[model samples]
Target: MTAPNPSTHDQAARLVEAVNEALTPATSYRDASLLPAVGPTPPVPQPGRPPMSQRATDASALMLTAGLATAPPGLIAIGLLVASGYADPLVIGMICAAPAVIAVPVLAVARLLRGAQGIGAEHHHHYNGPVSQHTVHTETKTRGLFAKTINKQ
Candidate 1:
């Protein structure tokens, strides 16, 4: 091979120097005590909706996990039963419709109860003679596990 070019050798030397400079730390000591103490990061607040409680979040996670874990096994069992001619059409239909049948009445009752809360007798106030009245109305709204109260005077 021919002799290496002087310019190429100089470029390689400059590149090696740059890499070495980049690898070297600005500070001499790598000890942890030399670094500034950092506190735990604060949680970022979400806008719009309020935060869910740990218990509610845990319950939801558990339900989701249980559903995921059980679905495949349940489906496999049903498939085996159907293939073996052990499950009849009527029994299969009932099994398919079971959740809807159980849910309908429960949902209806919940709706009825919720609707009943909005139905109430009107309040009538009558003042006789000269009277000054000051009224303060406080409204409390509960969503999930958190309650927010608003006072209006």
Candidate 2:
């Protein structure tokens, strides 16, 4: 069977419906204060690391990018010359094309690395990072089938 072809408005409406469903809280969970407290919160201690210097990072990145940019041209030249000795056009064509094809990804990666390096890794407090011993005490409503069997045994 062919897939249903939804119009742009239909797609948008479906998306809105899904968003509304997600935003609306469950009736049971509407009053969170009604639930009993679970055990004490788990401790999440931050691991300390020696701070890195931005100058050192930038220098290394510059050196790496320079090396990447030069390596491909040198390899392509050498590879074609070596492959030409085999007297195979197919081998020579493949060898010539391989470096050119790989060059795009290499440059993209170098650009990405440069951009990331430019945004110096200063410690920012990310939301999903370790939460201080704050417990959102909510208990599971039902036990697992295995859990019920285990308790009986």
**Best-matching candidate per lDDT:** 1
For candidate 2, which ten residues in a row score worst on lDDT? 144-153
lDDT tens digits by residue: candidate 2, 1-153: 966667877998999999999999877755556554775777566675334588877887899899899978877777777767854667667866997899999999999987784555785766776677553555555666665322221
The superposed Cα distance between candidate 2 and the true structure at residue 87, in angstroms, equals 11
lDDT of 1 by residue, 27-141 (tens): 7755666654776877788895468998988888899999899989988988898999988978988988999999999999999988886646997779889988787666556
Evaluate model 1: give its TM-score: 0.43
TM value for model 2: 0.24
Clashing pairs in 2: none
Q: CA lDDT, every prediction?
A: 0.85, 0.74
Every model's TM-score: 0.43, 0.24
Error of 1 at 26 (Å): 29
